[model samples]
Target: MYNPVRRNRNIGTENQGFGQNNRLQISTPYGTLKSFYERIEKYQKEVRIINDHEFLFIEEETRENCHHTCTFDDLESIIKQIPKEDYGDLKFIILRQPKRKEEILSPV
Candidate 1:
């Protein structure tokens, strides 16, 4: 009987697997934002987030990884996240918006 509404009632009987991990891995990136991990000055990261809602996680390596929104509107803040020391090591993005945009910053 192929019934989509039927729920499986089988319990206790189980097929075994070779390995299992019951703990969450903190190092792994989750949700919509990509994580940037490394050491950073604690309060400096906090100041950046206070100025912009677009700024998400901003913390040091011992505390947590930094996060920023990747959508078009907040992409500038994301670009600013790149550490100046690592500028040569990281690649830059060129978009056609101001990245083509000029001056008009508000909607009236």
Candidate 2:
């Protein structure tokens, strides 16, 4: 797993939110692109950018919460994945399907 640089300036432990301690506690967002690609290369997933409009990647079924939308990760992550300075016009090609059940001819 790739751990991003953690700055202690404004972080709170235990997933705290606003108004509880008068501030929000969140993980530091945006790591270096080198760290980002290191993660990708470690997983050996393929990626491609099309016409500066679409970004595509293949990921394995590893995390319980991960899906095709890639929302658990944020736009800070989106740039590393999409590599776009301006991401408003980017279109997506999501291709993920539930695994098909295997046939059981015999229960033995």
Candidate 3:
């Protein structure tokens, strides 16, 4: 007997796995926006959440241009804010920083 209802339930489980793969590795300790804001503020650095998988940290802000960068310490700070149990399926965290204007303007 082929049960359509049973098949649908199995399909739902498969979909759940897909969603899990797309979530951020870091889980907020307080589970609130206010907590996230406060924790980030302690760094005294500007951050931009690019997506569930990535974030950008701005290191230098200037009148003409801004420098976005990340360091080992930055990653450590972020990891410290998350609970160990919340890491779920996250193998790595990628950080991207834009090149400085001077670097772009200057030749190799």
Quick one: best lDDT, which candidate? 3
Candidate 1 weakest ten by summed lDDT? 94-103
Q: List the candidate numbers ranked by TM-score, top first.
A: 3, 2, 1
Each candidate structure's TM-score, on Cα atoms with residue i matched to residue i, is 0.17, 0.20, 0.25
lDDT per model vs. reference? 0.36, 0.43, 0.46
Writing each residue's lDDT as its tens digit, candidate 1 over 12-58 gives 44634323555433343455354322212342232223222233333
Clashes of each: 3, 0, 0
Candidate 1: residue pairs that collide: 97-100, 97-101, 98-101
Q: Rank the candidates by lDDT, best first.
A: 3, 2, 1
Candidate 3 stretches greater than 4 Å from native: 1-66, 97-108
Q: Model 3 TM-score? A: 0.25
lDDT of 3 by residue, 9-36 (tens): 5455656555555643334565577532
- Superposed by TM-score, candidate 2 places the C-alpha of residue 103 at a distance from the truth, in angstroms, of 38
Q: Pick the candidate with the highest TM-score.
A: 3
Per-residue lDDT of 92 in model 1: 26
lDDT tens readout by residue for model 2, 10-106: 4676554535665432223476544212333213244454445545554545446655556323432556565455566654433333322211221
